[model samples]
Target: MSTPTSPGEGAPTDALGRALRLVSFAMLGGVVAIAAVAVFTVGDEAGSGVDAFGAILVSVVFVAAALFVPRRLVRPWPATAAPNEVKAAGQLRSAAFLSLVFAELPTLIGLVNSFARGVWLPVAIGALFSVAGLLLTAPTADRLREWLARMESAGARTGL
Candidate 1:
């Protein structure tokens, strides 16, 4: 298995890995910031039971998106480019960004619920899911390389 590499920590050939690491960390930071705000401001009591229900619904949707969107976004392109090609880098970056966004959605929704309904449960749930999902699905250098390898293999098998 390839060891995970941080931004600028790998050889020159690992530029894509470095870039992906930076992007992933930045996205994770944003999610964490939103969660922090929700967690810190948990005393508002303006939310109705209906708002709580809506929060539940949103949380479910966010979980579903987090589970499925990354796989879909990382699907191999039709091009026959090599795994190390520039096209692969673009695909990897796009996949990482989209995945991070999906992972962060629950936290964003939770923050909004906190502000709009002042409900604590929804905000708490959203914060939990956001932090957990972001940590669990964080993009690493190894993951980027693995994805590229899978894409390259798929393209070759399909004769793209």
Candidate 2:
């Protein structure tokens, strides 16, 4: 289905979505970057729970600010493409939100491991899945329109 939003019209939402996407992914990437910089920078190991918590916190803070900040600070930019393109922006935004939310669980688990004791192997595996989930659903905002159509069709068949 076609997205109804104009490209730049959803900038506020779009920006938040983009922020969520990048920041969450960065949590994972940052770990790699940090490890490369120094295998042992902290008292705890590089791949410990504290690192994961820090990464997730950074992503959440960035996204929350983008979502709640005044439009003045988060001004809407002009449409990058035709009006048709704008429609998909909302889907992208939604996808970003969902992807980030999905990512948090594994990160949170990893975060907890920092304070407590848990098996890193499972949490690490879960984190990879979370990252994949986020990436796979990045286009979710656009899919909302499609889902709506399916719902409507189902309702009609059921005589609702």
Taking all chains together, each candidate's TM-score versus the true structure is 0.70, 0.37
Tens digits of per-residue lDDT, candidate 2, 41-109, equal 223434555655655555455344333332222122233433333443444444445445554455454
In candidate 2, list every pair of residues with a backbone clash.
Answer: 5-86, 5-87, 6-86, 7-86, 49-114, 91-141, 91-142
Candidate 2: global Cα-lDDT? 0.42
Off by over 4 Å in 1: 1-13, 42-57, 77-84, 155-160
lDDT of each: 0.64, 0.42
C-alpha displacement of 91 in model 2, angstroms? 9.1
How many residue pairs in model 1 have overlapping backbones?
A: 0
